[model samples]
Target: MRQRLIGGIGRLLAGLRSPPHAVLAHAVFPADEPLSTLPCVALDTETTGLNVLRDRIVSIGALRLSGGSRDNTPPLDYLVHPGIRIPARSSAIHGISDTDVAYAPSFALVAPSLLGYWQRRVLVGHNIAFDLAILRHEAERIRLPFHPPAAALDIGLLYAGLKPRVATITLEAIAADFGVTVDGRHTALGDAETAARIWSHLLPALSRLGVATLGTARSLMAKQRDLLHGQAGAGWAIGDLLPPHRGPQHEGAPHG
Candidate 1:
């Protein structure tokens, strides 16, 4: 599995004219590596709007969780100047005004560090496809090759998969269901901390569903492809997860 991961990333790297420092050769992990042993980074992005084609990321929040540690690494929060006027309605939702980001760095300036920090860790978040999409756009705008983490988990999708009958799967709803406190509701870092907590709470449930490893989690999330596509309609910015297949000769792994 490790070799397969290496080969897969190698192929991707070979295609890149110049893979950035973010594309570390050692970032890829074995498919069957246990989830509990793998580090995870909970991420969130506050954007200008819902349209991936036009909107830009205004802020990014990410925190590293070592071996699924409840106490996560110090969080990284960046406010970005999106180079366009921030809509008043959008500002009303996230509380990030033009003045707030007036002195902030542009996405191009932040991309290297942000992508580097995100490399080699499983990315977890609530309805994360949208966040991933926004980041992909930012990377493309800067002509940076966005090589996302080997795996990404969506708490909303995971919850929906486990409790298919539930109607509400909002970030607030999922955090509330898991008794996670919502301190930073709209801010990137605050939401990321909440997501990390929700992921910690959801781990046991995931295990019970037979999703014990990164590969199995990939399988589980793949089942939520429809939901993922709906979240990131452009399709290009969604699902940074490694495919379930180990090789062409083998069938795709069993879904969680």
Candidate 2:
């Protein structure tokens, strides 16, 4: 009886093994034909509320992206107290109440330091457009010359390309499905760190599936945006194009 049980388990394991013919089909994220390599920042923003035009970012989080193929800096982070009162609902999500930010400097005061870290680097986030929108709004509000980072990326969007038929996609869902830790639940810095870790992990599946480079990933985002939204003229639709939206039509920002 024991022998039979062992044999049954062996067969189950064998059934799970990759087919021999298809094994080794995809290597690491193979370099793309164009866009050799570049710096990337997995970034996140925490806001007082969700309105691209009205809500304010209370904190900013980021981690430097790295892979064996590139030499990049270690992780870094920042926090900004948006010059506004934090609504009760918003405070609950991020744990940043108006009292917490009252002593914190305004976005203008903190922009230079963050900008110094991000210039010429690609931006990454889960649902990155929200981060980008908040960042863009704050920068522009300070009259800081706002230029899109070298590029903006959404791991949430990228994952969809890897598994297009998935019925639903959310950060928590992806983490659970892929055996990743959902650390730092809602904090911007914690979330950014998680985003970077996820990107590192998902690259293998992505490379195998032909999302082998930054350009390919960005291209996928643009095309997917068209499919999902089905028309343009929406501000904040692109990277940091607008603020995160908690309310209806406060403003429709595009995907990053």
Top-TM-score structure, candidate number: 1
Model 1 scores a C-alpha lDDT of: 0.73
Residue 151 C-alpha lDDT in model 2: 62
Regions more than 4 Å wrong, model 2: 1-37, 68-74, 226-235, 239-256
TM-score of each: 0.82, 0.74
Per residue, candidate 1 scores C-alpha lDDT tens digits across 1-256 of 2342334234333434335654564367777888887888899989898777799988888888865674434466778789999999999999998987876778876766666676778788886766887788778888888777767777777888788788888888888888889987998888998888888888888899888787777777667655655554444344365364421221232122
The digit string of per-residue lDDT tens for model 2 on 1-256 reads 2342344334334423535323222222322533224466778888876666777887777766554122455344445567767888887888777666655556765555555555666677787766677678777788886555656677777788788888566778887777879887788878887787777777787778777776576666655654335212233435332223412232333433
- Assess candidate 1 and give its TM-score to the true structure: 0.82
- State residue 221's C-alpha deviation in candidate 2, in Å: 1.4
Top model by lDDT, which number? Answer: 1
**Any runs in candidate 1 off by more than 4 Å, and if so which?**
1-26, 70-72, 232-236, 242-256
Residue-level lDDT for 33 in candidate 1: 88
